[model samples]
Target: MNTVSQTLGQAPSAHVYKNDVRRKLLLIVVFFILTVLAVITDLLCGSGTLPWHVALNGVFHPDQASPMVHVVMWDLRMPVTITAVLSGIGLAIAGSLMQTVLDNPLAEPFTLGISSAAGFGAALVIVFQTSLVSFLPVDYLLTANAFIFSLVTVLFIGIFAARKGLSVEMIVMLGIAVHFIFSALLGLAQYVANVDQLQSLVFWMMGSLQKSTWTQVGINAVIIVLVVPILLLLSWQISALRGFGEQAQVLGISVARLRMLLLTFSALLASAITATIGVVGFIGLVAPHVARMLVGEDQRFAQLMTMIVGALIMTLSSIVSKMLIPGVILPIGMVTSLLGVPFFVWLVFGRSMGRR
Candidate 1:
């Protein structure tokens, strides 16, 4: 009789839990739809307008369309939209990994000085292209320098964190210090640069998809495709790491090794995107929190939702960047910042008020 009664009592809770799961799954579907819509919007609403059907046709059957429309759609619009999606997904994953591993709400590539380091490297290329070994073309030089410097910054942080015993406070503090150092270096570059070089450096730092090309987009897509499955496979471990913390070690999770592995993975993702596209801010910091809200603490769901949310945010930002001025495209970084700050402020204040 007691067992029967307990079973009956538990059934209601289990039913409620199932309902909650269904609701979150429904929400994920909704986000997926929104992301698709955002991508369509990006394809349709660029500098020159195209009919929806025409854009769709041009995308899939470009040979059937006018050469001008085909080139615009395939060569220009396609690459940027794809780049935005890939960058968004990569950065969101990186940000979530950093937040979980570092146990800091504000943990992100930007906060950890990774993007700043990349900017400094790009600035060097922009300001002194002739002086800094001009064997490679400008585009490759910029990417090479950004990638190298960003990795160097990560190495620096890793060494310091290892020395300091990998405490959260030490990592965050060192990240902040590194960010400031890179910022100062970037400032110096700007000061010494000629007017054209200064303009290029400043614009690159602001970020844009205007420079997106098929090759760059394809490279980012391939890297993201390769990495995401591994991340998803380890999602449960990541979730446990976030929830269990010190207890994770007792549970045989190899907390230190896991942290280092995820940190390197996340940094690599962030550095690749940052190196290629300059700096697209706030999506990394904001997307993961939004995903957490929708998906709770399960890293699998959060990871998927974070990618969708990141893609949606970037696509929307791309659309807004062009539409804000009819003929003038604002930097995507500027648009993201303008949209992201208000959302970020609300999130911080809401969390503080215990309104999660």
Candidate 2:
């Protein structure tokens, strides 16, 4: 009788589990469809608004399309649209990994000073006309500098965290300190810059998709493709760490090593994107939470959803940037900041109230 009772009790739970999985899967598909629509909307809504048929023809049959349509679609809009998507994916994934590894809801590349560091690095090149790598072309000097500085900042933070056995809170505080330090340095760089240098530095810091190219798109794609599989392979361990560091360590997960690895990869993703397109904020912080809300905290599903949500948000932001000024495209970073600031406020207060 007891055995029968146990079996009957377990049956409902198994069925419920299957149902939950199905629901999550369905949500993923739904979000994916939404992302596709958002991408199409982005491709359609640029300055010289092409009709769907024209846009489709330009994309699919460039040879047959008018020269103007082909140039507008291929030479201009396509790279920007693709870059936004790739940047969103990269930032969101980096944010998700940082949050999970650090066990802090607010931890992300921007908040952790990685983006600021990259900006400062880029500013160095802009102000001094200096190349960190002698072999890099003049065009790539700023990018290389940004990437290297961002990497160095994260490595410093990771090493400090590992050596000091800092708590999550301490790690966040350290990041904040790093952020302030870099901001001050960036300000100093700007203060001494000439009119042209200042204008260029300010614009880059504001983030724009205007400078994106096929080469940048390819580089961003390769980074995302490489980093994602490594994270996926360690998803189970990451999910476990999200629960409790002590527990994860007990399970032989090497929490310290895992955290260091995540930090490095997150920095890599954030740095590469920031170097390529300047500092677009909040996607990292916002997308992971949205993904978690939709799919709970299973890293596998949450990470994938985070990428989709990030891409959707970014693509939508790109559309808004174009539409807001009619003829003038507002900086993409400004749009994201406007959207993100309110959400960030709510996130902070809501968490505080929940704690109380």
Candidate 3:
């Protein structure tokens, strides 16, 4: 007993804390470096006729660069990459929030019904686009309408769950129901769409930044800046509330309020991304988990790492997507899903073994 007591007393408390701090700092640095690399790669690598040298110069000295380089780097590439990075950040944050609130490792923006709801809304606009132009600008009409309808899905879940003090099962089921209904509506709308509308909707559904514009980017940036800070403020509450529902309540946190606020921000974030770039799958599900595993689940580390990891993935995937076909451009969602699915399989089956 004397020997055991002495050995336990020498367990190295200060050393452990110092090592943890060092590891966290190292992870933070790595995330930043990767994010920078992803952005630079996005700028330098594309299918455009001009080389990397001209594209780099074009960022600051557009006059000296070739017209194609200017258009590709600034007009096209910049907006798309920016949108992708922001969307990734938004989705990753949403995923982290859902996982915490739902108390499920698999909860994500799409799983919670935001994507399906937004998809339905976009499909409705696409089906009736020709008829709605007089009421609103063709582009603006579709984006706004989609956003509003997606909010309805989130509201439905929030309201239902909140009424009974916001059961995790209830919210999850509500989201599932919303997904089914919206999916049905989307299919029906697709059935009635004209050729041009169908093509546009299909492409949008597949997801791409091929159509990025300064106006869309501006609107998204405004919404992101407004919404993300709100999310950031809740970071501490989220970390503390990671406990199961009853424990969370006992801890003096309002579960319903937290869920509502987080859900609203998540809905807006997903809507903005869907409106601009369509649905980039698995980002929400995949990114937060990666962050959590890398740096632990403390919300500060989780959120920061989530954003950095997400942005890097999006930017890199986008570059790969464009380069895959040389001259042809594939949808961003396609690339994400292609990469995300394999990663997810590994996360589910393989990662557990490594942890053990």
Top-scoring candidate (TM-score):
2
**After aligning candidate 1 to the native by TM-score, how far in Å is the CA of 235 from where it should be?**
0.9
lDDT of 2 by residue, 59-98 (tens): 8899999999998889899999999999989989988888
Q: What is the TM-score of each candidate against the true structure?
A: 0.94, 0.95, 0.91
* Residue 298 accuracy (lDDT) in model 1: 88
Give the per-residue lDDT digits (tens) of candidate 1, residues 80-110.
8999899999889889888987888877766
Off by over 4 Å in 2: 1-11
Q: lDDT per prediction?
A: 0.86, 0.88, 0.80
- TM-score of decoy 3: 0.91
Q: What 10-residue stretch in candidate 2 is worst by lDDT?
A: 4-13
* Model 2: how far residue 126 lies from native, Å: 1.0
Better of 1 and 2 by TM-score: 2
- Give Cα distance to truth, residue 241, candidate 3, Å: 1.2
Off by over 4 Å in 3: 1-15, 63-68, 130-135, 350-356
lDDT of 1: 0.86
The residue pairs that clash in candidate 3, if any, are 161-166
Pitting candidate 1 against candidate 3, the one with the higher TM-score is 1
